[model samples]
Target: MAFGQGNGLQRQVISTLDNQGRDVMGLDTLAWKYPDSSIVSGSLLTVESNHFCVLKSRGAVLDVYETGQHQIITPDKPILGNIVQGFFGGNSPWQYEAIYVQRSKLLAQNKGIATSKEMAIMEYTVDYYVHVDTKDDAVKLITHMPFAGERIPMAELTAYAGPVIEQAINQIVQVTPMEQINERIHDIIELAKGHLSEFLDIYGVHLNDVKVLIMPQDARMRELISLRAFGMSELEAVRMYLALKMADMGLVSAPNAAAGTPFQIGSSTLGTFDVGATAGLPK
Candidate 1:
C-alpha cells in the first residue's frame, strides 16, 4: 500500500502493459531498463515491458518509448496545487526546499537510489509563494488565496488592486455616444450600491443580529459603501463617474469606447421620465 500525503488515504497500483496486453509488474525490472530522465528531477519512470517505458511527473503520465502510438495518462492527484507555477515561484519554492533536502538524504541513505513520484509529491508542498521577492511582491503575485492562507502585505495588495482599478476606469471612460456613457455611470453607481448591500447582508454585525438602519441616501455613506463594494478608492469612483458624464454630453469618447454608442435609457432624474423614451426600437 504505497500512499502519499495530501492524496489522502488511497492505494495506487503502477503497472505496465506489454504489446500482447500483459501486465509487467516489477519495480526493480522497470528501474533497471528505463533510467529516470535527468531533465526533470523526481520524475517517475516505469517499464511497461522490455520494449516500452512510461514516465510519470506531476499528475501526468506519458509513454514515450512507444514510437508510433504513445499513451498519455493524466492522473488525479488530489493534493496538487491549482495554480502550480504562479502560486509557487514558477516551479520551485522554499517550502519544497526542505523536501528536496530530505529526498537527497534519503537517496544518500539508499546509496543514490531513485525515489517514487508519490514520495516527491509528499516531500514538498509545491510552493506557490516562491517567486515573491518581498512580502509585498507576494500579495501582488497571489491571484486566489488558498482555503486557509495568511494575509498578503500592503505593497502586494496595492499591486494586485492596481489592474482591477484600471479595468474599472476603462469601463467607465470608454463609452460611445455621450448619452450612453451617462447611463453607464448610473449603472456603475447602482452596481456599487448593490455590492454594498450584499456586503452588509454577509457580515453586518447588528445589535444582537437586529438589522441596522443604514440610510443609502447619505452622500458620504453612499461613497463609503461604493468604495467597499468595488474595493476601490473614493477618487477612482469619482473619476469613473466624471468620465461617464463626459461621454453622456457627446464629448470625446474614451479610446476603449470607440465602438458605436449604445441606446440610452431615460433617467428618473430627467424631466418626465418615460419608459417609452426609446421603446419599440429594433434590436
Candidate 2:
C-alpha cells in the first residue's frame, strides 16, 4: 500500500482516541461500541491507561490490547476474520467489534442471610475489590458486562458477586453455632475470599481482598455466651439474670444474709456475688 493511501485510510477510517469523549475515565460503562463496525486493516486502535480494548470476530476474542494504540490487521485476526483479504480482489475491511474495558481495581459490596446447619439465621455482609488479572480475564468479564459506552459499572460486577458472597456465608454458617458466629466471622472472611477468588477466577477476575460483616440474629445468645465464658454455668447464668431482673423490678431486697449462712435458693443476691460481712450479726 502506498504511504499516501495508508494515510488516507488512517485519517478517514479511524480517529485518535479522544479523552474528551465517551472514553473518559470514571465512566460506569463496561463495554463500549467501537465507532466503526467495519474495521479496515491498519486502522488505529487506541486504549488509554487503566483500560483494555478487546477485538472480537464471530463472538470469539480476536485480540486484546492494553493502554496503547494498536492497529487492526486481517492476517493476524482470530476466528473467521483471519482469512486473507487478497482473495476478495484487495485488502478489505472485516466485520468485527472492538470493546473497551476498565482495568482499575473495583470495590463490590454484597449481603445475604445465611442459615446454619443448626437452623440459625445469620445476616452477613461482604465487601471486596477486583481487577482484571490478564488479557484472558478481561474478555471473560465482558461476557456479563456488555458495553454501555466505554465503562463497565462496578454495580454490575458486584451484582454478580452477591451470589458468590451468599454461598460463602452459607458454607461458613452451616457448621458454626449462633453463639460463636461473631468470633468466627474473621475466619469466615478468609474462607469467603477463597470461595470468591475460586469462582471469579473462571472469568479471569482476581480478588484483591475481602471483608466479612456479620450481625448475629440473636444478641441475647451472645450475651449468654459471655456469661458462660466467665465461669458461670448455664443454669447459674439464668438465675443470675433472673435475680438482676427482679432487683430492678424492686420485687426483692438486696442480700443481708447472716454470717456463715449457706447460699439459699430464695436469696435476692446472685450465688456468685459476694454477700460481704453479715450485717447486725456477731463476728
Which is the leading candidate under TM-score?
2
Clashes found in each candidate (C-alpha, N, C closer than 3 A)? 6, 7
Clashing pairs in 2: 29-151, 29-152, 30-151, 30-152, 31-147, 32-149, 117-174
Model 1 stretches with alpha carbons more than 4 Å out: 1-151, 176-184, 189-283
User: lDDT tens digits, residues 84-181, model 2?
Assistant: 44454334445577777667787778877887667966777787888785777888888755554544666766777788788777877888876677
List, residue by residue over 18-82, the lDDT tens digit for candidate 1.
Answer: 44554333221112111112122222323222323324354233323332233222332332344
In order, what lDDT does every prediction score? 0.28, 0.63
Candidate 1: worst-modelled 10 consecutive residues by lDDT: 100-109
Error of 2 at 34 (Å): 3.1
